[model samples]
Target: MTHRFVGVGALTDVPRVAVVIDVMRAFTVAAWAFSRGAERIVLASSEEEALALKAASPGWLALKDGPPAAGFDAVNSPGLMRSADLAGRTVVQKTTAGTVGALAVADAPLVLCASFVVAGATARFLRAEGREPVTFVVTGEDGRADEDLACAEYIGRRITDSDVEAGPYLRRARTSKAAGELADGVRRGYRGVDPDDVELCLEADRFDFVMAARREESLLVLRPLPRAAVDDGGEERRTARR
Candidate 1:
C-alpha cells in the first residue's frame, strides 16, 4: 500500500480510503462523545444541515464551530462532553476541519476520521484491509497545522510503512508556531481552541474503534466501528451523494 499526505487544499485526488485527521479537538471530542454512550453522530457538511437535522429528528444534538447553539446540548469540545448525558442521543457535528475534510473526500470508497484516540485502530485497519495507494488528508485550520500533520504521521508510522513517533512529534507540535496561533485564537475569542482540547487531542490509542463517515439522506453520518470488525459486517456503507 502506498501512503501520501496532503493538506485539505489538495482534496481533489483521493484514494479508496482517505483517513482524515483532526486531532486538535473536533474528532477527539467525537470519540469521547461516542464512548460516553452517544447513539449516533451526523457529520453535517454545513451549519444549515445540522440545524435542519436537529429540527427533523428527536434526540439529536447540533454543534457548529464555536459553542453549542442556544437549544443544543453541547459543542465540539472534549471538556464539555466529559460530563454531559449522551446516553442514546444522536450528535450532529459541523466543525472547521474534521467534518469538513471528510465531507470533501466523501467520494472515496471509505472515509475514516482519525485522531490520536483512534490512531491505533486506523493503522490496524489500513494494515489489514486498506487497498493500495491509500492517502492521508491532514485538515488544518488555515492552511496546515502541526497537530493535524503530526496525527497523519503517527497513523503513517503505525501502518508499518512510515516512521514517526508521538514523543518528539507532539513536543514540537505543542510548541510550534501553529500552537501559538491557536492559543491566540482562543484569546481572541475563537471557537474550538480550549487548552483542554489540546491536552485531550494528544493522547494516543485512547479508543479501540475508529469513526467513519457515510452519506445519509441530506447528511453524512459518522459513527464509530470497531477496528477488528471492519470486514466482519460492520457495514461502512455510503447512503447518498449529491
Candidate 2:
C-alpha cells in the first residue's frame, strides 16, 4: 500500500481512504473539544448552516465566522477546549479549509480528520489496513499551510514505520510562509488566531482517539472512531478501522 499527498485546492483524485489534515487548528480544535466531553461534532458546509443548526438546538455550540455569533460558545479555537467546560455539549463546526477538504473527499470509503494529535494512530491504521492506497489531503488555510503539510509528511513517514520525529516537521512548519500568518493572523485577523493553538497542535498523539466522519443526509457527523482509546497516548492502540 502506498500514500499520496495533495494540497487543499488540488485534490483531483480520490483514494480508498481519505485522511484530511488541518493541524493548524480546525481538526485539532475538534479533537480537543471531544476530549473535553463534547458529545459529537456536526460538520457544516458553511457558517450559515452551522448557525442555523445551532439555532435548532439551543445548547449546541456553533463555531462560526467573525466575532462569536450572538450566542456561540466559542470560535474555532483549540485552546478553548482546554479551558471551556464543554462537557456534554454538541459542536457545530464550519471551517474555511479543513471541513471543506474532508467533504471534497467524502466519496472515499473512509474519511477521517488527521492532526498531529492522531498522526501516529492514522499511520498505524494505514499500515494495518494496507489493502489499498491512502491519500492525505492537506487543507491549507486557503492554498497550503505549513502545519497541514507537516502533519501529512509526518503521517506518511509513519505509514512505513520510519523514524519520524515530530519536531522537524513542526520546525519546518513554523518557519514556512503560512505559519507566519499563524502568528500574524492573516485570514482570520490577529484576534481570531491563537499562537497557543498552533503550539497545542504540535502535540503529537495528544489524544487517545482518532476522529472519523460519517455522512448523514448531506451532513457529516464526526466522532471519535468507536472505542478508539490510545493506551499510553494511544500509540499502542494502533488498531485499524476496517
Candidate 3:
C-alpha cells in the first residue's frame, strides 16, 4: 500500500484512514498523558478555551500550549507529562498545530492520534490491516518542521511498501540539532529528557492500539480501537519506564 505524508492544510482527497502527528508537543503530550493513566483528553481549538475548561474542572483538566513568551500551566513538554498525577483524569490541550491539525481532518473516514511514542503501535495497526491507502498528516509549523514530521516519517517507513523512500521526510522530522541548540541557549531547558523518547518516537509499530479522534460534545476526544480489540501483548507494560 502507498503511504503519503502531507501537511495539515494540504489534506485533500480524504483517504480511508489518516494518522495525525504533532510530536514536539501536542500528540506527544497526549500519548504521554494517556500512558500515564489519563482517562481521556479534550483537545481545544485555542488556549482560552483550554483555560476555561481547566478553570471549570480544576484538577480534572491540565492545560498545555500557549505563547512561549507567556507560559501556561504546561508547555507541550512530554517530560512534564511524566510528573503529573493524571490517573483517572483528563487533559485539555490547545496546541498551535497539533490540535488544529486534528480538527482540520476531523471529517476523515478514520483519524488516528499518532506520535513518536506510539509510532510502533500505529505502524503495527496499519500493517495488520493490509493494503489500504493511508495518509500520515504531519502537523507542521503552519506546515513546517518541528517533530511532527519526524514522527510521521517514522510511522510511514514502518507501514508503507518496502520500496518507498521516506528518507526526505525522516530527515525533515529530526529536530534534535535544533532542540539541542535551544536547550543550550536557555536555562533549565529540557536537556534531561530521555533521548530514548526521540528514538522511541522513531520506532515503527510498537503498540497495537489505534487512537481515533472524534467530536464529543463541543470538544475533541480521542478513542482507542474500534470494534475489534487486538491483544496489547504487553506493550502497555513497557510504558512504565517513562
Residue 166 shift from truth in candidate 1, angstroms: 1.9
lDDT of 3 by residue, 64-83 (tens): 55324232455566655667
Q: How accurate is candidate 3 locally (lDDT)?
A: 0.64
Worst 10 residues of 3 by lDDT: 233-242
Relative to the unseen true structure, what is the C-alpha lDDT of residue 119 in candidate 3, on a scale of 0 to 100?
69
For candidate 1, report its TM-score.
Answer: 0.86
Candidate 1, residues 1-242, lDDT tens digits: the string is: 67788877876665677888887677888899889988778888788878888899876888767754665557777766777788988998888888878888877777788888888878877776646577788888543677878778878887885344568667756875656765776678766556566666677888888787777766677787764464343344222111
Per-candidate count of clashing residue pairs (backbone under 3 Å): 0, 1, 8
Q: lDDT of all the models against the reference?
A: 0.74, 0.74, 0.64
Worst 10 residues of 2 by lDDT: 231-240
lDDT of 1: 0.74
